[model samples]
Target: MLKSGFGPKALLSFACLMAPLSALAQDATSSSPATNEVIGLRANLSPADVRGPLNYEPTKGPLESFFPDCSVDKQMASELSEAFGEALISFDPENKEVRFGVAYKGLSGNAIMAHFHDGAPGVNGPVLQTICGHPPPTSAIGVSATAVMGDKCPVGNHGVLSGTWQLTDHDCPEGSDKSCISRTVDEQVQLLACGNLYVNIHTCLNQPGEVAGQITPVNWIGKEQNCNALPPKSSQ
Candidate 1:
């Protein structure tokens, strides 16, 4: 990744590194570029992409201290597994913030929380930021994470969450306990451009996630993003 205020040589290298970035797209993605005018990332949440975190069995910390497992009944599991959702993300270079919105339906229970996690396509990273930031006592109120944040998201089998993640002294958005990927907003945008960010929706039935999707840049979105917030090439 190009560091802030990098020189021309670094810019060239950054361009080269981005040449094959479309390789990041999964087979499910479209071969066609988006027809509309837009630059951002999109995630298609589904159960097939759902993966439980790596768990090692052996004497260690309390076994109870674990992520919610697939303990939902088979019938409900089948239905919830069919749940799907989407998350849209983009960055504002001027303000140094990440703007995102999430909508999902068919959850077995009300969403407990929703977060932006960092990791490779099939890997699991800790919560990078909380787009809908809610936890424990607050989440236990049985409302959607959006509602906990004072947003007007309807509850039940469907829900929506939206917020801006801006650079601040705190690791995460205020009121969240999740670990942040970076305190710098630029780094967070870099993560999105690199397809390292994902949205995960949590429910009491699926504590880790009821549905989730890897955030992928739309068309040349990532490749074209001036994440370094640099001036135009002509100006340089």
Candidate 2:
């Protein structure tokens, strides 16, 4: 005789359980037609062409006091003759990310901090993001000549002369005012495109800003490209 729990009702229940399993197996083996949803869609509709490597030269003139009492001295400014450096910004609008590599030498004192500040040319503004050198736990300097890139600060001992910053994490200023930071990567991209962003390096000698440079694009001919001269890209 058939088992007590293995009668018609049990067979029906087993069949029911196997139906979905069979369907799942068919689905696992079958190939569906590819969808065309994103096949021809352009990643960035804006023709601003702001996505590329940018160059900057940090000097003394862009320095501005963040504190009322700590102004950069003219004599100290004159002494930054050997304290020159270059910064490179690589922006990826589609990915909503930015990569920065900055290097400097011959600072008046130990490097303390570096940042990308939001401000117009020749004007001082609040720190929009810290690139490196917020010490105690974190090193005040990064490795010299070594390049790092990512959405966060690189791991391990970075020298005091060079470093990188990724815009994905720690891309905002340390303040209550939301206005001090860009709300979106697109906005930051716009700020960069319009020449509204700059890099600042702070030292123990000059807490405000020791060396600063307005970030700007470099053309194919190795010349600075003025963002204002380019016509606005057609809105998407």
How would you encode candidate 1's per-residue C-alpha lDDT over 57-107 as one tens digit per residue?
A: 214432223323223322344443558776655544455555555657677
Question: How accurate locally is residue 171 in candidate 1, as Cα lDDT from 0 to 100?
Answer: 47
Q: Indicate the worst ten consecutive residues by lDDT in candidate 2.
A: 36-45
What TM-score would every model get versus the actual structure?
A: 0.57, 0.45
Model 2 over residues 67-86: C-alpha lDDT tens digits? 21124333343444346554
Residue 62 error, candidate 1, Å: 13
TM-score of 2: 0.45
- In terms of lDDT, model 1 sits at 0.51
**How much lDDT does each candidate structure score?**
0.51, 0.39
Best by TM-score: 1
What is model 2's C-alpha RMSD?
Answer: 21.5
- Return the top candidate by lDDT: 1
